[model samples]
Target chain A: MTSPRRVTPEPFVWLMFSAGGVVAALILPVLLVLFGVAIPLGWVEAPDHAHLLAVLRHPLTRLALFGVCALALVHAAHRLRFTVEHTFRLGRYDPAIATVTYGAAAAGAAAAAYLLLTAFG
Target chain B: MISPLEARYYRRRMPLLWWAHRRSYAIFVLRELSSAFVALFIVELLLLVRATARGPAAYESFLDTMAHPAMIVLNLIALAFVLLHAITFANLTPRAMIVRLRGRRVPSRVVLAGVYAGWLLVTAFLAWLLVAA
Candidate 1:
C-alpha cells in the first residue's frame, strides 16, 4: 500500500465572492443612474436619447467599465486561493504580493469603471 | 381572509468572511465607495447651477462663498482623485470586454489611447464645425 496522505478540504468562499462581485459591478452603475442621479436631476427633464448616448459613450465609460471586469479577474484568481494555499504552502512573500496585486488591480478597475460610467453613462 | 404563503428559498450571506476572502470584498467595496465623489461633484455643481438661476444673490453666493479659495482648492484635489478614479478604470475596460485579436492579447494602454484619440478627434471636429458656422 502507498503511504497515507494528509488532506484538507479547499474552501470555496472566494469563488462565490468574486462571482457576486462581477455581477454587482455591471448592475451597480445602471442602478446608480436610475436611482441616485436621475431623480435628483429630474427624470422628466432629462436629456433625450442622443445626449444620453453621448454622455454614456464618453471616454469615462471605458474607465468605469474596468470596475465590473476587474472584480471578475480578481474573483478568478481568488477562487484558487485555497488551492494555492495548500499546493506549496506559500506565504508572506508571494501570497502577500498576490493579495496586494488583487487589491490594486481591483482598485484600478474600479477607477476606470466609475470614470467611464459617470462621464459616459 | 387570505393566508400568507410561505416564502421561497432565500440565499444566505455570511456575517463576516474569512480574512483572505474578506479583504478582496472590502477592496471591491472601498474602490466603489471612493468613486462616489465624482458623482457628488457633478450633481452638486448641477444643483449649484440650478440654484444660481433662481436669483442674483443666489448666484453671487454660489460664485463667492461656494467658490471660495478653500473650497476651490478642495475641489481641485477632489478633481485629481476623481480623475485618478476615472483613468484607472478606463485602462481596465478591455479585460472586461473579453475581446481578442490576431491570436495575441491586446494591451489596455492601446485601448485607452485609441479611446482618447477618438475623443480628441471628435472634439476638434465639433469645434471646427461650430466655429465655421
Candidate 2:
C-alpha cells in the first residue's frame, strides 16, 4: 500500500513571520519617528549619548532589542522570499529560495544574539 | 466540440514596471522594500551595541557618525518607508486575525482598534521611559 507524504513544517515558519509582523507593527514606527525624524529634524532633542548608552546597557533593554531584531529579520526574510519568488516567477525553486531566505534570517539572528550577549555581558 | 483556435487565449506578460502602473501596487512594492530598511536599522543597532561594548568614546563616535547630514537624510527616508510599512501591516491585521467572543465573530473594526490601541500604549510607555530617564 502506498503511504501518504508527510506535511512540511511550514506553519511554524509562518507563525514566526506573524509574530514578527505584530512586533514590528507595534514598535518600529515609534522608533523610526523618534530617532529618524524628531531628533534629526530638531523637533525633539536627541537623547544624550551617555543616556542612550545607559539604556542600551540595561539588561531588559538589550533583551528587548535582541528579540525585535531577530524576529524582524525572520519577518523580512519571509516577505522578501515571497516577493522575489512571485515577482520573478521562481516558484519552481521553492526549496532553494526558502533555504536561502530562512538561512540568512537564522544567521542574522545568531549574529544579533552574539553581539547582544557579548556586548553587554 | 470546441476548436483549438477558439480555446487559445493570449497571455499578456507582466511588465517590469507593472507595479508602477497602479498606486496600490506601488504601495505594496514599497512596503516590501521597507523590510530592507528595517534590516538596516537592526544592523545599525548591532553596531550601536558594539560601540557601547567598546565604551563611551566609541559610543560617542558612533553618535557623531549618525549625526552626519547624509545619515540623517537616509534615516528620514527610512522613517517614511517604515511608517508606511507599519500602517499597511496594521491595516491588514484585522483580515489576518479572526477574533470571536461568545460564539459570534468579532467585528473587524474592533480588531483594528485593538491593534492600534496596543501600539499607542507601547509607544506611550517607551516615550515615558525615555523622558523619565
Candidate 3:
C-alpha cells in the first residue's frame, strides 16, 4: 500500500494547538475579566464608546486583536476536534473531523482579518 | 419452568456520557467546552469591531446592547468558563514545556507561577494604557 501515508498533518496542527494554548491561557482570561466581568459589573470604569473605538482604530491594536482572535479560534478548534473524536469514538472519521474543525477556524480567522482591515481602511 | 438462557457476545462501547463518571473526566470536558466560549468571545469582539467601524452611534448602540441584563449574564457565564480554561491550561503548561535551569529541571509550580505572573503583568499594562489614554 502507498507506504501507509508517511506524512501526517498532525505535527503542524499540534504546533498551532500548543502555541494557541499558550496565547489563550495567558491572554484570554484577562480579556474576559476586563470586558466581560469587570466593566459589566461596574468594577472598572467602562471606557466610552468613542475611546474604545479609537483604540481599535490603531494598526498595532488591530494586529494584536487579530492575532488573539486567530489563535483562540485555532485553539478551540483543535481541542474540540480531538475531544469529539475521542468521546464519540470516531476513529474512521478523523480526516473529516480535522477538516471541519480546522477549516472553520481558518475561515473564522480570515473573516476576522478581513473585518479588521476593511473596518480600519 | 424457565428455559436456560443462551450466552450472547455483545460489543459494549463506552457510554456516550462516560465523562460524567469521573471528576477528572468531567473537568476535562469542561475545559474543552470552555474553548468554545473563548471562540464565542472572539466572535463578539469581531462584531464589536464591525460596529465601531459603522459609526459612533452604532458602536454606542452595540455597547448598550452588550450592557443589557441578559447579555451581562451571558458574559458572566462566559467569563467563568474562560477562567476555567485559563486555570487548567496554566496547571498543564509545565507538563507541556519542560524547562531546564542549567542541568536541573525547573519546578512545575514555578512554571505555573511564571504563567500567572506574566498574565498579571500584561493585564496591568493594558489597564494602565486604557486609563492613561
Candidate 4:
C-alpha cells in the first residue's frame, strides 16, 4: 500500500497576502462606491472616514486587518532574515546570525507600529 | 572518496543547486520580511494623518497618546527598522520580480532607478493631496 501523502511544512508568507487580501476586500467595495458613484456625483470626499467606519464597525474586518498584520509581521520577519542569509551568503561573510534575527524583528515592529498607531489614531 | 581537489570542486558547485532548489523559499522570506516595516510605517502615518485632519482636540489626543514613553520608543525603533527594510527591499526587488532585459541580468543601478522613481511618484502624489486639501 502507498503511504499517505505528506503535507508541505507551513508557509507563513502567504499570511501577509491573506491580510492584504482581507483589507482590500473590505475596503474595495466602499472605494468603488465612492469613486464610481459618490465622487462622480460629488458626494464623497477622498478623505472621508465613512468607509473607515464601515471597516471599524465590522468585527470581521477589524480582526482580519489587525490579526493579519500581527501574523504577517512575524512571518515576514522570519522570511526576511532567511532570504538575507541566503542571498548575501551573509552567513559566510557577516558570521553573525543575531544581526539577521534582530533586523527581522525590527522590520516587523515597524509594520506593527504603522497598523496600530496610525490606523487606530 | 578521496581527493582534496574533488571536495573543493563540489563545494563550489553546491551554490547552484542551493539557489535553484531554494529560490522560492528565499523570495518568500524577503517579501514577507519587508512587509513588516512597510506595515508599521503605513499605520503610523495613517494615524498621524487622521489625527491632524480631525482638528485640535484630536491632535491633542495624539499628543496625549504620544506622551507615553513606550510609544516614543516604539516609533524610534520603527523608524530605524523601516529604513533598514526599505534599503534591503529596493536592492532585492529586481530579483524578486525576476526583472531582466534581453536575457542579461539588469544592472543594480537600473533597479535602483526604478525604486527611486517609485518613491518620487508616491511622494509627489501625497504632496498634491496636501496642497489641494
| Candidates, DockQ | 0.03, 0.55, 0.59, 0.09
How well is each residue in B1-133 modelled by candidate 2, as lDDT tens digits? 7678856864457776777889898778888888878777777768877887788788778767877899889988888877777898899988998999999999999999998899999998887666445
| Tens digit per residue, CA lDDT, model 2, A12-51 | 8889888887787788777777766576566777666667
In terms of docking quality, model 3 is: medium
lDDT of 3 by residue, B1-133 (tens): 4334422444467988889999999888888888888889888878878988898788778777777889889988998888898887788888888999999999998988898898889878777666446
Per-chain TM-score, chain A, candidate 4: 0.42
Off by over 4 Å in 1: A1-121, B1-30, B55-57, B98-107, B118-133
Residue A8 alpha-carbon offset, candidate 1, angstroms? 35
Q: B7 in model 2: Cα distance from truth in Å? A: 7.9
Which candidate tops DockQ?
3
Weakest 10 consecutive residues, lDDT, candidate 3 chain A? A1-10
lDDT of 4 by residue, B71-114 (tens): 65655555444444445555656666556789987787787788
Give the TM-scores of the predictions, in the order they appear.
Answer: 0.35, 0.86, 0.88, 0.39
Q: What DockQ does candidate 1 score?
A: 0.03
- When candidate 2 is compared with the true two-chain complex, its DockQ is 0.55
> In candidate 3, which residue ranges exceed 4 Å CA deviation?
A1-5, B1-12
Better of 2 and 3 by DockQ: 3
Model 1 lDDT, full chain set: 0.45
User: How would you encode candidate 3's per-residue C-alpha lDDT over A2-109 as one tens digit per residue?
Assistant: 566578778887888878877877777766677666776677876776787788889999899888888889989999998888777786798899899889999999
Instruction: Using DockQ, rank the candidates from best to worst.
Output: 3, 2, 4, 1
lDDT of each residue in B78-127, candidate 1, tens digit only: 55544444454555566655556888767777766765565456445433
